[model samples]
Target: MTSLLLYFLLGIISAIIGALPLGAVNLAVIRATTTQTILNAFYIILTAGVGEILLATLALYYNIELSHFFTQHPWVQGSFIFTFFFIGIYLLFIKNKINTKNYPKLHTSKLITGFSLATLNPPVAIYWILAISWIDKYIFELTPHTSFVSLLLFFFGIYLGKTTTLYCYGLWGHKIAQQKNSKTKLSRILGVALIILSIFQGIKFIAE
Candidate 1:
């Protein structure tokens, strides 16, 4: 019972930390809520959570090997840096060509959008790898049985945290969409945040 509680807590904490940052997934969720229905946004977040679960499972299974590999090939970090940088630049500079007047019909299906977005983002994989490493170092002993049970709890927590956070963002975005010229402002804010995060990650990579 204590081990279960500890694993659950670790999952909750790690997931909250991972999702707290403003990233493509959160921004996408917010945007979906703003332009579409909250239900649609929920679907998107749910699918993204599924993706995270898969990644977390894989990371737990190969924690030691992945940690060693990441340590040896630091260039893999560059994928995360470049992805965020590109997204920041695109969001900051690229003008939206889509007509907002047709927003109802313009959006893609939430499940597909979420799955594709999560799959394409390398940072999510990196996050899981680091999370597993942290768990191994500071959390409970990760024997085969413990690892399976702990990671199962951890992924469940991740899904809960992610869905909760995105739901909050969805609600906030839905509210904010009622204001005048709010979407543009939100886009700019997300863009800047992504750029800042990219730089932060770059520095952390170098320091490590």
Candidate 2:
């Protein structure tokens, strides 16, 4: 009842916080809005939301197993480090890799790109795993024992919050596109920002 709704609202808040950050998926949404139509941006947003909620659901259901797995294999953490470093280097040193002009067809179908971008980001996956654990201890006690209906409500809230936040990012991208009309420059700036963010996170992971 009321307790179930609390899980829903917590899921929304957690999702908004997670989605607000600059990640590959948010950048994809921005790129779609800038290069393609808002409708295309929505397409990406929808798939991205699906991907995130899937991850969140997995995290919710297997929180204990996942935590145990990470504890058992510390080297798995280095995988995350490598991924962040690779993305940061590719974005910063590489020459306009995301340049949509070079691959116009790629932008035409944002569905796969959106899902790939969302699910493949190591940082996002780690965020969900860590977020669920932290929330279980500090915010709310989520466990496999939690009711299935409560988990469903939380998953729904995650989907709603993720798409809404990404739509807002699309709107911001559209505004910048209308004003600047320089997709390359905007993309490069966001790319650099993402690199900085990724590296910072990677370092944090190592330090932890």
Candidate 3:
């Protein structure tokens, strides 16, 4: 039981730390919160959490198979490049109405938007594989041979930690959004950060 608890705690700590970085998932959560209500942003958080755990689970059990799949499919990688470049461009220059008076209703299901944001990146699986390997080496020894109950605990902890980290970001966004004068400024800052991040992703693809 103590061993199982360790697995779960490891999952929580790892996820919280992992989600702290500025990336697609947390950016989307921060965007949602800043644009709308904190509660609505949580709709994105819940589904995004689901998507993150799904990717982590696949990577944990099928690291080699997934690695081969990404290598074999050039189109999948191409899509990520296109997506990053497109989003970067859009955010950098696109002018849209910012209605700070009232939160706008999302046309799409917040859940679907969040899930797609989390799941579309194929390389995130690789991150999980690398992260798990590092954790296994220095933190604890986890393997494909790990017991099912422990894996379950770990996954659930991942879900919880991911959402919690995102919620913290949501709170930050809410605080910024609450500032009546900063909506446009926030958009510009987020746009620049996203563009930089996307460029970094492109550079990583080339380097790898």
Candidate 4:
């Protein structure tokens, strides 16, 4: 149907938006190792794709109110802020503790990090809230019969696009990591950025 094509185009746009940022997950992958293993990176990316699709699906089923609740709740917001603070401190202050003398292996635990990084980040959630809300309200609102199908297709497109972005970033990060002898500087910068962002968000949440 004509309506379906419009929704599909919208879905593609949402996918591009979601995939634009190289967030913590890819950053970690980049910092961890410097190897060109596209196949392995693709595997990790597949997991990320599934996570993104799941989040988008949930966001569509819910809406802005749900995202606002999570962002506004004292306990939830405080916990996330605290977690970010600690992670930043550890990465910045205790770089020696990470045993960077040797490259770390990406394993099952790292996948958990990927999932948590995607799910817990407020910005990611907010982006999904906006994208999913717009897609639902503007594109799928009139097509009652095609609602679920449209959502599924949109989610699929988003997952693929985002995953592809990560894979590309992985390649770049891998190459960069190999050439860079100093991780401390980059780690410090990233850590400080995280700390500042968390503090700003925490204050805003409290004020709200």
Candidate 5:
């Protein structure tokens, strides 16, 4: 019981610290909250948390092997590049305004959108690997079972933290939407940001 409590506490702290930084997943959550219901935003955060757990698990168990594989795999790099570009194009070309009253239902389910967006992001996997390495070096010992439990709790904390942050952003968005004709402005800003992220991803891919 003591061991479990310690691990769980560590998990929460680590995940909260890690998630404080802004990133693509954070942006997506904010976007979802702005356009969809808070429940839908939670769905996005839940799936993203699941993705984090999977990545952290893989990092804990097979860090060295996976690192080598990712380094060697051109296809993996290509896939990331293509995915970013595709998403960027899609967002950039989105003509319809994303107002709550007239928000068109997306073809993709929120669950799938959240999962795929989080999972396909190469940085998340790399971040997990690095985070695991740090935890192994500085924190508690990581046996197979302990690593699993700890990371599970950690990602749960991440989900909670992320949800909180996105909800705040959602409220901010809601305020803006209530102002004179701001939904279109918000959508345009998000679209441009995604496009910029895509460009950065492409450059990073080439540099790597």
Candidate 6:
């Protein structure tokens, strides 16, 4: 019983660590703002948390040296930056192709978006490696068997934190939408932010 409680605590901590940033998922939710946007973003963020949980679990159990791979083949980081850059370009230029009017109202697809954002981003992978290493040290001192369980708890916490953050964004969007402000201006601002961030990440990747 005490062991189970410990695992729960671990999950909470890891989730908080994993979900604190405004990355692609947050950008997507920001772009998709509507009456249903917050709920959709919540599910998206939840699935992303699940993906991180799985990755952390696999690395700890399999003894995968993710950091080593990342440091050695730094091009992998470039790929993620490229992906982000391409996404920003697409969002900025070809958004009309999405046919928002014909888009499905269902929330199930939100999970897919979340998973991709969490699993595919280079920073997310790096974050997990750092987070898992920290967790590994702490748990190995206690009991190796429980480390993975702790990561699972951390995953849940990440989703909880991310969902809460997105929910707040949704509320803000709703409030802002009620005003006469331009959504196009908001989107352009988001697009520029993504482009600049991606370029910075890409430059850092190449430098390392």
Candidates arranged by TM-score, highest first = 3, 1, 2, 4, 6, 5
For every model shown, the clashing-pair count is 0, 0, 0, 0, 0, 5
- lDDT leader: 3
Backbone collision tally, model 5: 0
Residue by residue across 1-208, what tens digits does model 6's lDDT show? 5765666666566655555455776676665564455666667656766666566555565445676777788878777788778877776666635678776766557779878776777687677666667766777332246565554555565556556665565566556556554465555556676788799887777676
What clash count does candidate 4 reach?
0
Alpha-carbon RMSD of each model: 3.0, 3.0, 3.1, 3.9, 4.3, 4.4
Which candidate do you rate higher for TM-score, 2 or 4? 2
List residue ranges in candidate 5 displaced over 4 A.
1-10, 13-28, 85-108, 143-155, 202-204
Q: Residue 206 deviation, candidate 2, in Å? A: 1.8
- Model 5, 1-208: lDDT tens digits are 6766666666556556555544566667766656666677677777876666676677878889878877888577667656656655655566443345666755667777777776776666776777778876787675455655655665566566545554565566666666664656665666676677667866877887
Q: Candidate 1 vs candidate 4: which has greater TM-score?
A: 1
What digit string (tens of lDDT, one per residue) describes model 1 on residues 73-164? 87776887878888877767673544568556555788988777765665677787877776777766643567567657766888887777
Q: Where does the lowest 10-residue lDDT sum fall in candidate 1?
A: 95-104
Lowest lDDT block of 10, candidate 6: 140-149
Structure candidate 6, residue pairs in collision: 11-153, 11-154, 15-154, 15-157, 15-158
- Return the top candidate by TM-score: 3
Off by over 4 Å in 4: 19-22, 32-40, 64-72, 96-117, 120-123, 138-145, 203-207
Model 2, 1-208: lDDT tens digits are: 8888898998898899999988778877887788777888898998998999878877777766766776677677667556655665665567465555555453346888788778766556667888888878997677777788988888888889999999999999998888754665775677677677767876776677
lDDT of 4 by residue, 79-133 (tens): 7678777778886899746675578754665566566666666556667877766
Off by over 4 Å in 1: 68-76, 96-107, 147-150
After TM-score superposition, the amount by which residue 14's alpha carbon in candidate 6 deviates from its true location, in angstroms, is 4.4
